[model samples]
Target chain A: MFLKLNEIGDKIAIAASGGKDSTVLAHIMKLLNERYLNRKIFFHWLLQRYDYGLDLFLLSIDEGISGYRDDSLETVKRNQLEYQLPLKILSYKDLYDWSMDDIVKEIGRKNNCTFCGVFRRQALDRGAVMLGVDQIVTGHNADDIAETVLMNILRGDIARLQRCTFIKTKSEETIPRSKPFKYTYEKEIVMYAYFKKLDYFSTECIYSPNAYRGHARVFLKDLEAIRPSTILDIIHSGEAFETSAESNPTNVTVPGVCNRCGYMSSRDLCKACLLLEGLNRGLPKLGIGNTEKLRKKHLDEKEKSIGEYSSSKRTPGNPFIQNFNDLKLGSDLKKPL
Target chain B: MKINLEFSGGLELLFDGLKQTSVVVEDSSLKNLFKKIESELITQNKELFLKDEKLRPGILVLINESDWELEGQYDYQLKDEDTIVLISTLHGG
Candidate 1:
């Protein structure tokens, strides 16, 4: 599925979560790159358009979920040594001044998934930036893409329903992220990991009682049990959707930079910034489900905070550290300011 | 009947962090082997592994490295040294 590997830069980072999919993916990527170099390209088109020079790095995020992330980072580190790749680890505590454990305390487990998911997305991009790698590959497989497609449909999120099926996702400010195993099945990944004896970590977050996705996944698995092709069919149907400016003119907003952190965002403040603002201000519910209220509240808050910060010459409303300069990650965890 | 059972994708956490175990069971089918494994093998988080007398939806079963679907699913007759791999795809990627 990632046939365009030749187009990527020499330095690429694999967003390794140390799960079965990622462990298998890290090994497969190395295998493919080596095959391409040894004149054993998998396809005729690859022989014409392939290059053999790519440096791989293993990048992981520590969500600070006590046993979950802490255990997984160990697997990632092991994979780094096994794969002979460099490793970089980032944490929510240092990046956002809050961990999943702390967030679950402030907000219940109900909406903590939203916080963890959004924060992890932005954190990956920022971590890639720190590593100076613009290309990132994740382990999202056919099952994941299909589940996300169903979730978007269930949520009536036309924007993401259209975007989730894409093999590669990118914005102006963020790294260009691709999924090498986009068309690969979950069973294939698990089997590969098993046969190769690749070491990985697997444990549910102690606090992630994510009901919505869990339900969707169970429903999809039932369908898959009846007909294994249902997973691919859902992904194909998602790709069949066509959402353009003419189709949804007013609903779609042009992507722009987040005024607070200057990250690529459809709104003035990205979801991460809004969520972070809510957490730091002790209003953890501000960015939870149905963001219309958060959008309106953020507008007023942003303007007022921008004005306040323009005079103080500091970051607008961010509570962790004034700016990235004041923040340090990777070595020691940062405490909330 | 002798069977080789391997658990992964966090399901092993419920099985005392044991990924691989060789068990001798009374029955020769996966349906019966599951009951044996659940009752004797799993000490904690039994609900995570089963619901309504069936393996949970997000969990996958493979026979000899092939999809269970290709191997007759839960009804596949077991043989000596058969490897039944159980993995959960529900964990966060």
Candidate 2:
């Protein structure tokens, strides 16, 4: 299934969460690279060879959620030595100035996962940049993909549903991310990790008690119990639908650099930047659903001072200078205008 | 029957964060073994690992390094010093 590894570049970061899927993936990739790529073989075998002269790193994100991410990161650090791979750690505190704990305290637990998820996605990219890796590989397996497909279908998110089944995904601006375990089963992964006695961290996030994705996962697990093939079937169905990433008229969000952090984004500000602004300014809701109005508000305020607002332009918002009460949402903050 | 049981991939979280345990049982069936483990080991969230008198859907059971499905799932007889492994495949990545 991973004969495609031959195409991967010289250096890549495995987005390991110290989970079963990634632990197995890391071991398998290293095994294949050593056994297959180092030898001179026949033409057919060469095509199947996985050697890309790859430099491997374990990239882990610390959401600073205390017991959860910190515990998991310890396992990642152990694997750094166990797997003979270097490790990189990026924290939400450094990236966005808010840990999941702090975000939860402000936003309330209801929507903090959204902040963590969005920030973690870009944090991986930024961590890759710091590590000097051009490609990022995650341990997303068949079950994960299927659950995402179901969730996207439930939410009527066609663009994301169509893209969820892809083995490799990259926007025009960000580093490429791939999932080699796309065809592997969660059962097989755990089994392999167990029989091999690989170390991993598995406690659920303390604050993730009521995530909507949890429902999708339970539904998918039930379906797998009845028929194991259902997971792959959902992925195949997802792949059957076609949604153009570029020309989707309804969701005209195209890739651009964030006006705040200069990271890849589809809007003036990336989700991380917007969420950071919300956290620092005490308006965590500003980063959640329907951010369009808040984004326009930022631009309009900028326009009043400069007399002209620029689209396709980057605005440098002051995250520290604006001050209100420590937890105040809107007033007395010395607004940008 | 004396058995060696191991739980992992967060399944251990149900067993008070224990990854491995050894127990002696008077009854030898896998079902009784599960009940014994539940009564003796499971500290909390019993339902996360068991449902409707069966192991939960996402937990994989292995006996002596082979899938329990190959060796008669819950009916497999436990032997002295037999190794049983239960791994949960349910957590997010």
Candidate 3:
């Protein structure tokens, strides 16, 4: 933990989601703060409203589990009351209004989970920045990291494999994000949670359709079953490799305030603005670029025209003569001298 | 230089998607190497690469242990024995 803390300074906020990993992370941060040198350590619990289609019954059920409909708000309130840490909870109701299908159609994402992940990241970053924290810590344990590594390999995403390793410090125009449990395994975190009896929600997100990651997790579990140290081996193997420092260039910082909603982004409009544009235009699939379908349609039209012309005229000369007559008879054509 | 590269989690799946195990390039710039790799991927699997006139988002590139987003984009220069890791952001909880 100390080694992990060395990477992040004293002023930090733990993103608590009321889940096992986050709860354990918050606890560990608190314990470390108490045992270590005297400094006013700040911990903020950040949570998002997990919208499940706004059914009153469902919302009531959610409220029953976490005193409030929003998990982040509840976690933050608890933190303030129990741990006495400066906490803030933010909520956005847009997710409930927009279905996973709606988001996917607008963003070209396959599932709701992808949309949620991106939205949550932006929300957390903005929230943390507003709170004025030096570093933002997440409960991304070893298992999650390992699972991510496996998934990235499967998807052939080279950039993600390189970037996912250590705690992510902010790039230019980005907030500094860190993961203290990057080295800590999921099992250890879970074990610690269970042993310490930390209060956390055991239920998975209702809309997590991560079949690919699920397969990776299962594959890793199978390998770990054969060799308990296999997880560590994978982690060490990831640590051993390095990416070419030159290959990754920072994104060109774009200058513009978002027209739809004011948010800092390099593009003239942020992703959210783009999504809204697509939605407003009723062209949810506009940006998805189903180029294959378009290509196929174009080929079909060309083939159909060719077939029509060839069938109508046995000699290619006849088609040319007909075209010449049509052009001559056209309104723009003048009489021949 | 023969560099042994390893990918974790979703990144390992890239090997399945790749036609070659290691990329051999005369140039040493990370940008050039990545361009070569992207070209190879496009040539082999045009359907995947040419989706939206660019490589799909959510995929990340890493040099050594740092994220390309953190280090630099494709412009990062490659040294002898440098390993590049490609991963996808597919993690969900």
Per-residue lDDT for A154-211 in model 3, tens only? 8866657757776666465555777878878765565465447565554334445467
- Name the candidate, 2 or 3, with the larger TM-score value: 2
lDDT, ranked from best to worst: 1, 2, 3
Predicted chain B of candidate 3, TM-score versus the true chain B: 0.61
lDDT of model 2, residue A106: 82
Global lDDT scores for all candidate models? 0.79, 0.75, 0.51
User: Model 3's CAPRI class?
Assistant: incorrect
Which regions of candidate 2 are displaced past 4 Å? A1-9, A41-50, A244-252, A297-299, A302-337
Q: Looking at candidate 3, what is the lDDT of residue A332?
A: 30
Model 1, residue A108: C-alpha shift (Å): 2.3
- Candidate 1 per-residue lDDT, tens place, B1-93, comes to 789999887788888889899999765788888888889999898998877778887677889988898988779999989999998765666
Off by over 4 Å in 3: A4-9, A38-76, A94-110, A244-266, A286-337, B1-93
Candidate that would win on DockQ: 2
Query: Which candidate do you rate higher for lDDT, 2 or 3?
Result: 2
Chain B TM per candidate, please? 0.93, 0.94, 0.61
How would you encode candidate 3's per-residue C-alpha lDDT over B1-93 as one tens digit per residue? 443344332333444534225655664666566555556634343433223343434345557756676676756777667777654433322
